[model samples]
Target: MPQPSKLHTRFVRQLLPLLVLAFVLSAASTTWFTHRSQLAQAQVQRSQTLVTLGAALVKPLWDCDGTTIQAVVQAMTDQPNVRSVLVQDQCNATTWQAGTQAQGPDLHTLTIPLLYYASTGRSYSVGALTITFTGVSVRTSLTHNVGLQLVVFATMLAAVLTGAAWVFRRIIGRPLHRLREAMRAHQELTPIPAHWAEELAEITATYNTQVQELRRQARHDPLTGLGNRTLLEEHLQRAIRRAERTRALGHVLLLDLDRFKPVNDTYGHAAGDAVLKTVAQRLLSCVRDTDTVARLGGDEFVVLTPDAPVEGSIQALAQRLRNAIEQPIDWNGRALQVRASIGVAQLLRDGTTSAALLASADAAMYAHKQQDR
Candidate 1:
């Protein structure tokens, strides 16, 4: 029962894990490279320090100065990270040794040959000096560096997630909420505001088109392309409400085609359809743009006039409608004449409710038809 539309669920289940994995892998790789580089630098520094020490001890071992050799070894051990140092003589005998030996895998050793200049002016190896470093300081520095890197990585990950959430709310969450509201209210779909992502914009555009077509199909007649009975009732109710608010009178006219059956029977259904279409156009031409003309059903139509003037105005509009319907329509090279019986009713005068007003108008139309017969 998980809703994919929920932003928090999507972020946690999908995006959060992906981002975390990527950050972990990147941080791990960076830490590994840093560790190797730090170890290499420590080794190079240790070797350089040992070579310098061995050179200084060469003169001491050659002169057999035990005090100087011991002093030098002690001083070398005193330097940071130096674990142990040993100096030997030409006979390969240990001359001086200082500091305790490191016993862990982190220990590193380097040995350098001690050379002396003989009286003959030729340099020869007199002894060897061995040095050992525990690498404790190096490991500490590496750990500190890794801890700093983790802090920076965490900060960057937080920033990326924050930006992503804002983008999701703007592009996905907000638009979806608006769409849901429009659906619940049964209103026309409003076009989504401009978005940074093109795919999202396209999706919004497609949704707008679909909703418009759905509304069109729901409210319009398929045959004459006019508003159907349902649309007429909705418009009538709205007009009644508006008239009540403005204290303006309104009118309703129901029209029934007088000879519509004869046209269908004598000329076939095709001619009947053409006649209906023609009558729809004529009705549209007779009224103002503010008025609503609707086809209730077969050969039956209704017109709603909001803010209508006096009774004289209503009668004049009805006469115009009858005249429009009586006009001859040319159908496939044949002149066909049709008449309509119209009933007029005034808003607030005839009735208040839509059903009551419609019944009154319908009765008036039937009375007019009987008189014509």
Candidate 2:
């Protein structure tokens, strides 16, 4: 099966016919207008030519000078549109005429009155001049003008189509293509660059935010807002590598809350949740910023110090953690208290890997809890 077409391709395909139709309508309207204008211009030109020629022929027609009248009529009839010219005296008899009869059926005739002024300051009608104009000249001019205008319209239409394609690709197609590729590759965030366009920017931002939230939820405990076992293992592995490289002493502490199940059994899980939140905050306050605190599960917590200094001993750190857990948590006007049993394991001395270290710390933590019992 063939692959589906892209968005821009589809858009162009859908819009092409409409653009072509519009071009055809525009060309037709322009040609019609040009034809009308050419006809009107021909009429104006014929009127002007007749007025000028009649003024020159007034004296000749009055004196019956056949030579001058014939010369003037022949001159005006020589024009391309003037098919024939006729001059008639006051008796309606032809004084002089030039050219043949109308060649085409479409023809126009205009007659102008020739007046002469005598020595007595009185003017009288001498004769009339009639000229016949052919429509062939106007038709030829309309055809040439319409052809030229069609070429111009075609050029402009091509330019508009090219510009439309460019705009669609830049503004709509590129961003969506990038988004499709990233999604296919299982990307965590959108890879599209800034300053491109706002069409898909909001969608990319929303997807990236959701991805970050999913990552955070995967590696953190929802109840206590502390690192989960997955995150703790990652931190431990990194700390183990650092300790092995620097040849420094590091410590891991495993802690278990004493009598924690009784609180959950008595006051319900809500009270137990409050107690766990309080414990998490106290653990954070007790440990250094360089230390990692994680909740492995119900009432079980672990702390990893990647770089334990010589001044701070493992026993002191464990004691501090134990004391912090022993503090009272306020819940509904009641002070709930619990004790913690912590076990310490020195990196490189007890175990090397995260699993081994955690096992060692767990065994020690159980032994200490039994002693408290």
Candidate 3:
């Protein structure tokens, strides 16, 4: 029996980590790009506002218009991204300042020189205007949208992964699981459903083929391809039950090779194996389709005939098996021959049980061998 496959378990274990990593990567990438774009846009807007405010104050400063200068500065302070605004005199000293302190977290300072243009196209520096822009404003706005984006991404990822998991289980995981269970239970596995995908169908087909081959190897003789003792016993038990039910006579014929050791000792085990295979083929030919032919290890064989007619039929069957075994076999351009001594035991006459019938047949076969000696 084969052990269960961990296809689903291993797939989940591996897929989950990869999906989490992908989600993390996607989220980070989206957030990073969004933040950078928003920050750049914010920087541009702040630059434009600073230039416009500087233009508005140039005339007020040049004419020494204190009321206008204060009014313009106050309006600039009221804008949301601007933390503070300050005006400096020609000496670079702060003349007027509004809003919070110039120094603060997530704030940037920009200074522009005030120039007075004359009729001759000559410019003179009047003073400078300094404005502090709050960098946190862009990030603050991003926070809400980022949350929504993350939620959307998460939902999409979950749906995709769920579909993928279902597809994987339907095509690969479930079929492999079924095959594993059938193998573990030592049961004949039905072929995978035709509706399954081609790859899974191919896999199950290959699996079933190998399983059948393994079963054949287990119950059969490797050399002769005949049913081995295990298979023989199984058939024998069934035959015994059937005979008991029908109240019919059955026969067990045990055949042991005479002069088989000489063939092995003189010609090596290879020739002896060839002789055995040939004999197995011969034995199969001599029996009816309902009968069973099995090899019980080296140079020994058993033929089971259930619902046999009479004593004469058993004798005729035994003679036919002996004749088949005595035929010349061609191996390696050499003719090799062997003989079999067959002993028959009648079911319900010699013994009722499989063990008893086999025992009786085995004993009778040895007696036949002794008589030939």
Candidate 4:
């Protein structure tokens, strides 16, 4: 089984940025917020020392003595973060005593907690103070700000990701899909047109040009630039179809040179090649444009006629081929007489395959060579 593809790319392309943003923003806000909270706690701790001082002087507040209250309040002022303390009666909410720093006596009626005596039932009454302090407002502000910021950030992130996905589909996905379709079309077609997209158009055009070149190569003889085997096969198949439809005869003439090998051995392979080329040119001149004469190999060639073959037509074609090849080929102040043997085969469709026809024609040509020798 193939391994499953991972969505790791989804994580990198989409989720990573959102997560990093959230982490960075959260860390920064939480750091400042935690600092402010700690600072407020520290301030609260400092003020808490005064609560201890007021509680210690409870005996004095309970009608015990002034000296005790004064001593306690004075001691609190000396403590590290303590400012002042005022013991007040809970029932009347009146200050019993104020510290040295608690100048002007009443301190506009300070409301620190005080423990007092009850005469009738012999019970105690305690007072509570409304104290003013710092750091509370700072901590509250931070809490509100951080909560609101996080909510806004989360909403904005969702919107951004949604927009990014939409753009990716529209801009990247659609264009890439179109380009792929164009490539597939080119692959399926014979003559791949210049369907290369704007970006890859030149590349596709080059491929199309290559395809055309390949077709030309398939149809032409490499040695003489004449029709090759593929073209010959096409011709024979078409001629068969034409004969079946119209009741006309078709002929394919196969030709091979007589004593051509001796010339090649005496003069060299280069001279032999030139002689074949010359033979091709002569055959081309002898036949009409509609007729095709092509070199099958070194000393072998074929001519295809789509129409009816007369009784003497085959011999006439052979004579032309022999005369054409016998012409002089001059090289190095020496004139060479080129020569070739010819054989003819007439085609009858008769449920015959292309390969069968070519093979029979080749056998007929070899027989002709035997007769000539």
Per-prediction TM-score: 0.75, 0.73, 0.74, 0.52
Q: How close is candidate 1 to the true structure, as a TM-score?
A: 0.75
**By TM-score, is 1 or 3 better?**
1
Between candidates 1 and 2, the one scoring higher on TM-score is 1
Order of the predicted models by TM-score, top scorer first: 1, 3, 2, 4
Tens digit of per-residue lDDT, candidate 3, span 100-150 = 886766788889888989889999787889999987454665574678867
- Clash number by candidate, in order: 0, 0, 0, 5
Q: Which lDDT tens digits does candidate 4 get at residues 1-373?
A: 9776543456446775766688577757775877677666766665565466556766665664656655765565565533454455543445544334443321222245454556665646565533322333444556656676667667766776677667656655554465467556644233333433455445446656766787788888887888888888888888878877887767777788887888899999888877777788988987777677877777888888777534366577678778888889877778888677666666674335556766777787789778877
Cα lDDT of candidate 2 equals 0.84
* Per-residue lDDT of model 2, residues 138-162, tens digit only: 4565577667767876887688779
Clashing pairs in 1: none
Worst 10 residues of 3 by lDDT: 136-145
Candidate 4, poorest ten consecutive residues by summed lDDT: 102-111
